[model samples]
Target: MRAHKITFAALAVIAGLSLTACQNDDDAAAKTDPSPVTTASPSSGDSGSDGSDPASPEASSGGKDTSAGTGSDKPGQAAKCRTDGLKITAIDNFIDGDPDGTVAVEMKNTSGRDCVIAGFAGVDLKTNAGTLSAERKGEPGDPYVLKSGKSIAFSVTYPLNETGGSGVRITGLVVTPPNETKSVTLPWPGKPSLPVTDGSGDPVRVGPIGSAGQGG
Candidate 1:
């Protein structure tokens, strides 16, 4: 009877040990593989307060689409329009003649719109001493139409002798478009001066005169 009681107790201990081992294996498996769960609640207002739809692609990307034109689609902006459509390119040459010297003014139309040059174009010669003398060339007539990307050349003959200088001094050259009082200055290679036969019978090199002045 004593031996049988001992065997019964051993069997009970083995059963308990087996049950505990199975429970431990289940707990480890659950920890290793976790499943994702979805909730009904929305994340934020941008996600849609009513929860009907997702945010637009732009909104989701965090900004508005700017590929399309938004503001200021005019050909030339207001500020650009204020200035004449013409831009001075190169002052080709200055020729010494009866007057001080004639300056060749070259210009380019840089604006998007076509430039119509109809009225008077003026070029001012300034001595190193800051004395300003202006020469007017071309009167109002048929507009000198310059399409976009086109160039035009005009001459402004000034009395270089009047300036009383061996070298022609050109402080500034400006062109005034029709109906517009403002003038745009033509860019020159260097300080305005050209050598040539002085107006006097005696040949005096007036310096480098503009090619336009020489009728080039």
Candidate 2:
């Protein structure tokens, strides 16, 4: 009976040791396992590693601004009109090409873009003797915004030569547009010779630049 009790006690101790070893192995496995990882997402205003922000002024401008300033696509900001971009012509409005007539000079904008013109046009009659400059005779008013394919005009008025007296023989005309230094030459539309001195003995007169198809 005593021998049987000793064997049972020894078996109980061996079972306890086996259970302890199992618990120690479970603890070691828990310590060696790795944890779960986490990552964050970028927000709307957040800048990435390159230090760029979507809401910033520099970013919104796309590194270059092309919508403002001169030469841009903005309206009414065109450059001034130049003589090289203009087409000038003249029409004599006298009955039977006689004196006491008016010469209507028209300037058309041939440039592909918009431009501006203002004030009086410089006028000089090309004659055999010399170039006779016509005197400016009215207010210039306001600056005119001449769009592409548009026109403006000025006029020259002279007295009638009823006596048939000796006068200047006009061959051509030298025209200068408003606010421009360059000039253009055009032929006189009608009778070349007109009395230099009027019935009252006065020189010819010129007018300011105005709308086309109108007097001066």
Candidate 3:
């Protein structure tokens, strides 16, 4: 009976050790294995690896900004009218084989790009006796953007002949562009006779430059 008790006690101790081993195994598995996670955490303010918030101006602009750069794809503002790109033509004849004293002035854009043109074109009718500056008439309208191969027409008004009066001789002429300091020189229109001014004030009258089909 004592031997049976000893055997039973030994069996009980063995069972206890097996249960402890099972408990230790379960704890190790829980510590090593990963828990179930369904989704990733949401990003905060689109921060970069350098911890910079994307919304900040420094982060958005970076070290070199390209918003105002010329190479950017964004559209830029229109450029102002320039004189060197203009081609001035003196129109003395309304049609072939006919001549008039109104001296029509026309300009063509040769800059190969779009440019703004406004106000009156400067006209200096040079003569041997005296030089006449154009007296501008009326206010300027909205600016006209002229592309390549486009043209605008204007006029300088003066009498062609005086009828028994000593007429002024036409020599060379000077043309000035609007809002520009440079001037273009053109030859005389075949020595046409112009009305002589009394030296009172500016003689030649200039019409405000307008688009095609628009009269001044």
Please report the candidate that would top lDDT against the real structure: 2
The backbone clash count of each candidate, in order, is 18, 0, 0
Candidates in order have lDDT scores of: 0.41, 0.62, 0.57
Q: Candidate 1: how many backbone clashes?
A: 18
- Flag clash pairs in model 2: none
* Top-TM-score candidate index: 2
Estimate, for each residue in 1-216, the C-alpha lDDT of model 1 and write its tens digit.
Answer: 111122566657667567678567667766766655668986554322221121122211122222211112244311112235656554535543344344455555578654333334444444454534343433333223344554555555443343345654445544554345687665544435533334443221221112132111
lDDT of 3: 0.57
Model 1: how large is the Cα RMSD against the reference? 21.3
lDDT tens digits, residues 9-66, model 3?
A: 6667667567678567667776666466679898655222221111222211112111
How many clashes does the backbone of model 3 have? 0
TM-score of 2: 0.58
Q: Tell me the tens digit of each residue's lDDT in model 2 across 1-216.
A: 111122666657667577678567657766666455678896565222222111222211122112212222333355566899888899976677554667888877788865555567888888877888877787754444455676777787766546576567888888888768899899988556667553456566778766324322
